[model samples]
Target: MTKHKCFLGLAILATLVATPAQAEEVSRKAADLMAQNSNSTDSVDQNSNNTQPPNTPLSPSLPSEPLYGGSDTASKLPASNYWYVSGSVGSASPGNDVQGSSIFNNKLNFALDSTSSWNIAGGYQRGNYRSELEISYSSFDVNNASIDTQSFPFSGNVSTTSILGNTYWDIPTGSKFRPYLGVGIGAGILSGKIKYQGQEADLGTGSSFAYQGKVGLEYELARKGNAFVEFKYLGIGKYQNDAGRDVTPPNSYGVNVGYRLGF
Candidate 1:
């Protein structure tokens, strides 16, 4: 036992006095000597050394990016692409020698009065041109009626409803106000009542070929609204009503004030 103790003491002193290079070499040798006593501790150390940083792996290409913004393309589109609707109210000025029916050519020499009128229309526009369909109504009360320029005839009311397809060319002044001229051709229906010699007669109803010409100007009010004034000339064909009351109203003229909405 005394001899074993002296040997162990000498080995420890040698290790402590050695240089770093020599120490590592000597430690390897000493670990071999300590293996019998330190095997259990070495097992724990191996478990700790097993933990390490993870390695990154290669991946596929990234996906494409997406586009942005609103889907309401119509709102951003040009003015030419807009569709619009309009309405108007105005006066119907009558013409002379309103004839009716194939019967007596019962020519009516009536002194007609200007009266109230209204119209509605819808259209599509592009550049400086527009195309539209319109329906208009007007009527007047007669103060006197004659047959063939003689003062012996029926007197009462005359009314007409017209539907027309129209197109216009806008004259731009580089301002908010736009002026235009247009023409239309379509059909009109006429009907009303009159009295002759204390006997009342139904003016009846008739459909005739019709045509018109118009001039107008529009003032922009809002982004989608406009106010306008228009003047128009109307020519209607002769036709008799259901009551055999032959009548053709004279060509008439009118002036109108209107509003329009667009999208």
Candidate 2:
């Protein structure tokens, strides 16, 4: 009976010890499960943060094209308009066929000689065109004279001055040398004195309408200057002197050389 009682007491003590160990193992397993759940939740939160969208900008980016449809090369082109002035000197050949009425009511005719001519001008130029105001002067020597088909030895000098408005057009050749044509209309004054048989008569001074035509070739000397040579024809209208004598001046041909300058 004592042995049986001792065996029962040992069995009860073993049961108590086993109960505490089982409780400790259950607590440890619960802690491990909670830690695993917390790690999984943290991993999910980190992945959500990494996958979020970025912040937007305040304005859009600019385009790569140029503004206002303009190109870089077009801004570098030369100017197309400017102002200029010019002068020329030349030789003139007067026509021999000059006619007039003498005081004696006789038909008079004159033969003339060549002379020197000169001019100065100022103007504006645009593109291939030009317009100018010109003042010119020329002179002639009388070779001989005749009254009613009767010839005589005559010695005299005739001089003329003109003011003209001229326009010119330059032809494009895509070279430094350019060709041009011109026309002018204006007024002129003519004056002369003649001697025959020791008697001198004043042909007097007169004013008339005048006109001219020109053709020329220009050579570029620099950006601001050009040299030119030209041929021209000038004609003066009929003139009536103070003495009541009617006179018609002859046509004149000329060759000129000149320079033109620009600003």
Candidate 3:
């Protein structure tokens, strides 16, 4: 009985110690598994924060691309074929010193007033220089003249047409305001009639030599348009009338406002 009791006590102690050890081992394993799960979850969150979001708007990312959608890549103006056109309207005033001679060999002087004028031009440009073809028109009435007591104080309507070839030099200062100098030469067609003291004379349509010079400033109004103001001096040589007399037109000075279109 004593030996059996002793064996029982030893068995019970062994069972108690083994139970606690197994419990400790199981707790340790559980803790390790929890740490691994926590680390895995933290790593997943960190990777998600570092990742970029989807569907962000990056531009159609080249300079040549259209802003919206197109396969065509030309988004800027073409380099070649820099052609342009212009239209202008302004005032034309005559000079005081133009004179002509009648069939009687008498000196006939004229005084003219300011008149309305307009022009249209088209051209191509290269390297700051441009060549243009222009057409212009103006009309005026002469109020006073001096040929004699009977032929003085003339009354008349004069219409002029000009077809000109022009060249321009644009001073490139890389600014929105462009300053330029221009010169033009062509033929003028003059036609009108004059009356002095109940005597009327017809000035037939005749071609005259013409020339002009200009100074202008342009403002960039848009990508393809410009507004400008210009000062011009235009001269026309004498033309002969059907009566074998001369019709001398006065030199003209003009101030103009204009718009230009480029293509």
Indicate which candidate wins on TM-score.
2
Order of quality (TM-score): 2, 3, 1
lDDT of 2 by residue, 74-138 (tens): 22222225677899999999865678887778988878899899999988877678899999898
Tell me the lDDT of candidate 1: 0.77
Distance from true position, residue 128, model 3, in Å?
A: 1.5
Q: Give lDDT tens digits, candidate 3, residues 1-263.
A: 45445544655555567787775665565556666766888999999897666786665565654541211223332122367899999999987534667778878776777899999999986656779999999988878877754446788877889999999887766555779999999999888777888988776778889999999998766654678999999889988877767777767899999998887
Please tell me which predicted candidate would have the highest lDDT against the true structure. 2
* Predicted candidate 1 versus true structure: per-residue lDDT over 1-263, tens digit per residue: 45445546656766799877786676566656566546767888988997754564456568865432222133322245468999999998886645554255656566677889999999977667889999999887777776665776457888889999999987866655889999999999887777777887676789889999999998767655679999999889887677656567667899999998888
Model 3: residues >4 Å from true position, as ranges?
A: 1-81, 149-151, 197-199
What is the Å distance of residue 161 in model 2 from its true position?
1.2
How many pairs collide in each candidate, listed in order?
A: 4, 0, 0
**Decoy 1 TM-score against native:** 0.65
Q: Give the 10-residue window scoring lowest on summed lDDT in candidate 1.
A: 68-77
After TM-score superposition, the amount by which residue 205's alpha carbon in candidate 1 deviates from its true location, in angstroms, is 0.9
Rate residue 212 of model 1 by lDDT: 98
Q: Estimate each model's TM-score.
A: 0.65, 0.69, 0.66
